[model samples]
Target: MFSRDSRAETRADTAKPGAIPTQPPRFSGPIGVVSSAAAPSYQPASPDRPTSILGPDISIYGEQLILKTKGSLLIQGHIEGDVHGETVTVDDGAHVKGVITARTIAIQGGVKGELKGSNVILHEHSVVEADIIQERLTVADGAHFEGSVKKAKNASEVTPDLS
Candidate 1:
């Protein structure tokens, strides 16, 4: 059996020219070795999926119930105020009672206020009763809508200044 010193010497002899040393380098400062378990995993965000979600049991009331998101927003509950997002989706059984402004707005539930978006879609199960201002508007068959629709020239033209 080789001794510790002999083992190190053997490693040195077998190493390639100008190769890194087999032994870990000594450091005077605190070591910062990061293992896989300690390191955080990164995932790319998806544009089609909402980053924020309001569950079915959730209910937001009052005029201060304004929800604004830079990413997509999904609502499965009841909201009594304005909502603004990059993409907004009102799921089935959800209800909104105020204005909605977004780049893209999809409704599968009920809306009772103005809706302004670059692109708007009302599913067959949706019920909307408000004025709509959009670059593109689509209403599926069986969708109940009682609103005036105004189409814009482009998405940029329809984008609202929420600030």
Candidate 2:
């Protein structure tokens, strides 16, 4: 088998005595990196809990998973587990198959489970097939839901932060 690796004539053994050696020129582009150590660390301005978002690329499956957040929770990805947050929003295009417990719930995606909240709203693009227990429930005109809705005895008592 013949190889063309030597086609560039880079072999030093084939060079003539006292002759200059040549190499392929390399050009530098505008690639650079910034060091964080050069700057001081950042400090939080407030004590409020930051919101948690499950991005579109996130996917959780297999055994049931449980997620709990003190602040608001947004689901824009796929989650096959239970979620408990102060306020939970299932954004459009999101897929969740589990129980969702929150003070306020807004769903605009696909959900299949039990939803317990003080106030729950199914947006126009929502597709929910699960039982919902809420004090106030609103289903948009274009929303598709196949589940039973029950009024909670004490809506205000339906809290997301359950220890």
Candidate 3:
């Protein structure tokens, strides 16, 4: 059986004089008593702080393959279902075939479904064929878009149903 008092055994061996300590110094108080400088800080992930990426080699296919995240999402792969995030970016050479709902959507690839966001940008290399609802819509030159765009009066009022 393992001994429970392992810290007692880990005390510095003081039998030999002028010897380097074999163990690290131990704290004797409750865990939280340690100073912040000596403790590891824990940070919660904020909805607009983290960025998640889907690599180019990955492919998602399903009837209801919804990818939802509180933070940003960068898709460099192929998705056959809906995507919801705070900020969604479909990189160049990527492909998506379902609805995309986000606060901001930047498409540099190919999308074939609905896109609803506060701000939507279609880059020069993007190929889109979806109906878009956004407060601000920007289509760069050379961006192939075959969809209708509906503009909202206030960007904050247009909230995409992330469900």
For this target, which candidate reaches the highest TM-score against the unseen true structure? 2
Model 1 TM-score (2 dp): 0.66
TM-score, candidate number 2: 0.68
Shift of residue 91 alpha carbon in model 1, Å: 0.4
lDDT of each: 0.73, 0.73, 0.74
Give the least accurate 10-residue stretch of model 3, judged by summed lDDT. Answer: 27-36
What does candidate 1's lDDT look like per residue over 9-79, in tens digits? 43433578889876732111101222323321222236554356687899999957788887767788999
The regions of model 1 sitting more than 4 angstroms off are 1-50, 153-157, 160-163
- My TM-score estimates for the predictions, one after another, are 0.66, 0.68, 0.67
lDDT of 2: 0.73
TM-score ranking from best to worst? 2, 3, 1
Per-residue lDDT tens digits for candidate 2, residues 87-146, read 787877898999999987878789999899987877766899999999878776777899
Q: Name the runs in model 2 displaced over 4 angstroms.
A: 1-47, 155-157
TM-score of 3: 0.67
